[model samples]
Target: MAVKIYGIKNCDTMAKARHWLEARGVEAVFHDYKALSIGQDVLEGWADRIGWQKLINTSGTTFRKLPDEDRADLDEAKALRLMQAQPSMIRRPILDTGDQLIAGFKPDIYENVFK
Candidate 1:
């Protein structure tokens, strides 16, 4: 199946991922999470496949900007709610290669998976 990359268009990592896929001539369907809000079921499905921990980008500004209470004692349900509300809280370039769900952009990982 073709790759479906879930990320914002302006993200630097997303740019690299797009370039890498284009260079390899791989078909990529970019699901811009900003433009297209991900459904709860769809997001939950990803979490089920990869785990909610992987879906939440703790290092991103979105997560950091959260109220201290939100960040202090987080759990799966709370994290999922936050991510659903703000896609930016999700890690960049979540790759869906049909069989697996990859949460972030890693050149070496992408090369190994797709090449």
Candidate 2:
């Protein structure tokens, strides 16, 4: 399967994920969403597959720094707008493994997916 790992390059989680993939010899392409913005349609598609709640990284500094108004009463539309404006607020290292979208880095999960 063609795997694509999407995230900001500087993120710590992303670094770990990349390292793990490399160590495992998993051939995957890295997409720097910070430099090249992720599209609204693409985000929408991901949201469709796995709800916006999972795609968003509320615990991250980017999201925590967001104004109270932006964080309040989130729906798909509002969340998408926030994510589009600040890609960093979207969770780190979303691995697209052709057949599935995996959010965040977990060794067990990666092993299962690749195996």
Candidate 3:
């Protein structure tokens, strides 16, 4: 299967997910959003697949640093635009497994999808 994981290298969750995949011998391409910018098309696709709430990482420092005005009243279009501008505002370890897309890493979810 063709699998690609997107996130920053230093992120703890990203590190864990990468380690998990490596331990299980699952090959995947890694896309560091910090180095490789995420475009509107890709952000929109992820939003469509998982919805804006799931795509946006409100818990991240990037999101917290945003102005209150920017964070308020978010819709799909606005969220996509913001994510395009600040890739770190999006959730980490977004996995594109050809057949499906998985956001965030959970042991049970990873096992079910990858194993």
CA shift at 2, candidate 1, in angstroms? 2.6
TM-score of 3: 0.95
Compose the digit string of candidate 3's lDDT tens values, residues 1-115: 6799999888999999999999999999999997889878888888788888898898889989999999999998888888889988889889999888888999899999965
Candidate 1 worst ten-residue window by lDDT: 106-115
* Candidate 1: residue 3 Cα off by (Å): 1.5
| Candidate 3 CA-lDDT value | 0.89
Please provide, for model 1 over 1-115, each residue's C-alpha lDDT reduced to its tens digit, 9 standing for 90 to 100: 8779899989999999999999999888989997888888988999899999999999999899888999988888998899999999889889999987898888889988875
Compared with the true structure, all predictions reach lDDT values of 0.90, 0.93, 0.89
Give me the displacement of residue 15 in model 3, in angstroms: 0.5
lDDT of 2 by residue, 2-107 (tens): 8999999988899999999999899889999999999999999999998999999999889999899999999999999999999998898899998999989998
Clash number for each model: 0, 0, 0
Give me the runs in candidate 1 sitting further than 4 Å from their true place: none
lDDT of 2 at 33: 96
Worst 10 residues of 2 by lDDT: 1-10
In TM-score terms, candidate 2 sits at 0.96
